[model samples]
Target: GSTMSQSEAAMAKANPMYNSIYSQLPQYFGEQPWTAGPVYVGAFVMFLFILGCFIVKGPLKWALLGATIFSILLSWGKNFMGLTDLFIDYVPMYNKFRAVSSILVIAEFTIPLLAIFALKEILSKPDTLKLKENRGGAIATLVLTAGVALILAVAPGIFFSGFITTQEMAALKQGLPAEHLAPLVANLTEMRKAIIASDAWRSFFIIVIGCVLLFLYQQRKLKASFTLAGIALLCLIDMWSINKRYLNDEQFVPKSKQTEAFVKTQADEMILQDTTLNYRVLNFIGFPGNTFNENNTAYWHKSVGGYHAAKLRRYQEMIDHHIMPEMQETYQAVATAGGQMDSVDASKFRVLNMLNTKYFIFPAGEQGQAVPVVNPYAYGNAWFVDKVQYVNNANEEIDALNDILPTETAVVDVKFKEQLKGVTEGYKDSLSTIQLTSYEPNRLVYKTFTPKDGVVVFSEIYYPGWRATIDGQPVDIARADYILRAINVPAGEHTIEMWFDPQSIQVTESIAYAALALLLIGVMVLAWTQRNKIAKKS
Candidate 1:
């Protein structure tokens, strides 16, 4: 059965048009603090909280404290190793902010204190912990109800992680970019918005729980021993199961289309590198392989992407199989000769994008397996070839080789021009345009065009840097990150090209990213410092 080639799949993985958050998971893992340690620490922390909860009195307060601690442990574990799919099943809302380990830690500290404050009101009421004679039955019912509810909440998470859905399986079969699953991939970007909703829900739950306990205190119906141990126990079990899962799988695990895209991408890169004159075969060539003097090894690497390499490899494999033993020597010689010529040819194409040649030649082998290589020239090397040899004789693979292409084919010269036209010729009601002044790497300036009434509508300035503004106004520039940005004008018209500021944009981005990193580092450092400062003050 034929499967889509890795090259085809590469188009998908190389550009993750959507499902970008899935890409961030790896980056988040790299940034997590706990990645340096064994993940089992979370499990250990869970055990400590469980033990502390059961051994302590004031069960609601203790249970709240335990939940807070357990959540923190789970958050860190998920953040570091990317162990989080199960959280999506049970507490889907939590999964969105799981990477925000520091925020979750703050929540853990705040939630328990809030629960304790709520507990204080209830316990201070008369006979809050005291149980009535018939209340044993009520307590038992509450315990069982809570335990069952807990199991219901937890079981789905444990089961869902073990299997992939039919959709994911289908994506793998389709190959790359998961074109069939594009819609699903697109949804991943909106996960942060979904996460915000989850946080609001958690806030609602906390408020409801606090209000109920406060109401009981106000009515004098609060009991000290009125504990929901069943609910607390269920929470403990669920938390423990989640911790166990995290401990078992600490890898940055990808799911569905994410996994398929990642795996296929790796496979494609491997094949391209192996088949082409990449890092493996052409260690001598600089990147883009456009040197004045060509390296044979680099030529071999560049040639692999062309038609010749494909046919050469096919013919060589055929010869190896003895399908055509007598033809092996001639085919091998031709492959070697073509490879040598291609190296020289590739340099000329590297100089310019337009002049880049795109054809290759492969002489026919003794067997019928040989095919011609096409697209021999790349950028800069377009017109560099002066002479070429072809196999014309049987004895000398060189002697047999022939150069059918004319000398002009050796080098290519390409010219591109843009003509300007009269502004009134294209559009009516147009008036005289003002002169353009000043240019930055990504920003350009021009005078606005006014109609006969002197009302300006458009401008006549060019943005070679990518963006142009008129009358100190900004224009929305797309593809500003690309190497070139050009604005066209019609023939017989006046136009000016000015470069905009790219360095400023790049510097701004670099500084902002650095500032963010420093800010995070500062926050963690400050938190630890404050803890020490408080300890000293105490």
Candidate 2:
């Protein structure tokens, strides 16, 4: 939950259009507040390769060196002491991404490539100049690795204090009691110190063993093949052992369990029985907490919430402005009543119902069971609105939702009002009705009847791809109620269809098919031309 909130906050702040509070927290900007063991082990390997640059010379060597330095600087994040701030401020799109440590993937690749080049140089047939120079470089690298390791082993605290700021520690305190905070902090500090000391000694030994093998190969005391095999074995063992500390066989589940991971629960089965298929489910059991973003509900039902790294900005804004606040209010009410609320307050869930959430799931008294409650006030798939209230901006449009009857009225942003050409204002047709006849991920069809021209609002997210047609004639789809689809419907019975057919997708697909056909034709021509040459050779 902390990670998700921090990531969301970072994303919101990075995008200037969003109305979110900018956080200055370290974790929000990809700074590690605690020790990461695997990173330390990986760093040791990278250091050895950095040293190898002294002997590994070529055009590829220079390219690798540049990549390695850039990757290292990015991976250092805010820890480089203000260097990363320059990139965040001046570099295009740098501030948009988090987890700066992941940039080390470049270093990971270059380090291994350099390591192989250095090993080849050391094992190759001795030429006096090259062999003498490489051996000295190898010795210097070994000394540096050993010296750093010895210092860490002797006084780990000298480099890292294992102390985190109060604000940093507060991020981890969610859902934890006050009494346990002090003990947890103390234990964390001790654990980090121990990891640093142990990994330091482990890295030292691996480097020393690698140096020994290279020294033997250089001296001609060991066969090249044998020396190479020994060094390879040493690297494999060193990396594997260190990695096993964090991940191992026990971490993997059985194939059968993996397959059954999203199998329908009792509550899910009950909810699926509705058969309406046009509504969404809100699973309160795992909501507003650590597992809130899990997609278990989405596996079988249209869910109001699901997890994704890059969610639609408009949808996220809707969640922030409407959904979360309402949910929090309901939770507080339940808490005040000593956690014995009989049912979710339907009045408090107006925003959720507007999003077409028709079912709510909560943990039952029995351990493995859950209760699914139907929302009585949920609006159907599509509805005819009596009035179109225009708001000047996004903030006003969202705020207007609080007082508007979502089923009876639609709130349209003034910026988008220009897109509504034939849409009529103050148009109320009480006799008009609309029902969703068919639904697919990319297409939706609705049957409607209107005594007079009226606007129809669909509880579907408005995105660029969707195109709406009324009886085969295309019409503009408007962004209604901040994040839903709305279209103007003429009087009389008509078929309204919406299809997600993006021009960009169609163009890219056509290009891909054409490229494939050209490649095939080229291959055939080459084979035919080569046939005569083969016949002559024969």
Error of 2 at 468 (Å): 2.4
lDDT of 2 by residue, 406-504 (tens): 877899988778666635463555678888999998999999998888888888999888998999999999999999988988889999999999998
Model 2: which ten-residue window has the lowest total lDDT? Answer: 17-26
What is each predicted model's overall lDDT from 0 to 1?
0.34, 0.72
Residue-wise lDDT of candidate 1 within 1-538, one digit each (tens)?
1111112221233335434424422111122343322222222123223332333246665557756766665665545444455565676466445244533655445454543453443355433334363235334433443333344333422322322234544554465455645554334223322332332343334333433553465466654455333224434554465355335454556576443532322223333443221111111122222221233322333322212312333223322332222123323543566655444433222211222223232324464222333333332211111222222232232111122122112111111111111111222132434443543434344433433212111111223344443233343321100111222222223333344466667899999999999999999999999999999999
Q: Candidate 1: list runs displaced more than 4 Å.
A: 1-149, 152-154, 157-162, 171-376, 379-484, 487-538
lDDT of 2: 0.72
